[model samples]
Target: MARAFNAKVRQREFYPGNLVLRKVLHIALDFRGKFANKYDGPFVVREVFSGEAIILSDMDGTENALPVNADALKKYYP
Candidate 1:
């Protein structure tokens, strides 16, 4: 099972200045509804930890107070 999973799993790496979108959780306080967009922000990646944690900043240069898991984000292309 581990081999099968690992075979398909590719590394997810993000660097500072990369654009990314955060996946919005349905249970989050600010979530609108099913019809709302699933992802939020073409936010900028401020820092990337060795672990799966990432720090993101808003387009206006304001950084988020907390670090988000890398799984919750995906690369954004303009």
Candidate 2:
């Protein structure tokens, strides 16, 4: 069974260079659930359009591109 992840309800201010991590709960067409997918790691913020952000994940010799919202993501730092 898939676990339910609470959506981010708070809006936060972000810039172009900000880094973020994809929430384990939020799932999109391009990327599957964080727990279901093989690539489970932090992605770098490439661009922000409106409320969606383009992120790049280089995991397991693959570059996965995903679009997510600020509220659907958490700040990621390594």
| Residue 40, model 2, lDDT | 40
lDDT of 2 by residue, 1-78 (tens): 223333534456655555566655534554433446532456555666774655454433344565666666666676
- Tens-digit lDDT string for candidate 1 (1-78): 999999998887899999999998777655455578889999999998888899999999999989999999999999
Worst 10 residues of 1 by lDDT: 26-35
Residue range with the least summed lDDT across 10 consecutive positions in model 2:
1-10
Candidates' C-alpha lDDT: 0.91, 0.56
lDDT of 1 at 49: 88
Error of 1 at 10 (Å): 1.2
What TM-score would every model get versus the actual structure? 0.84, 0.45
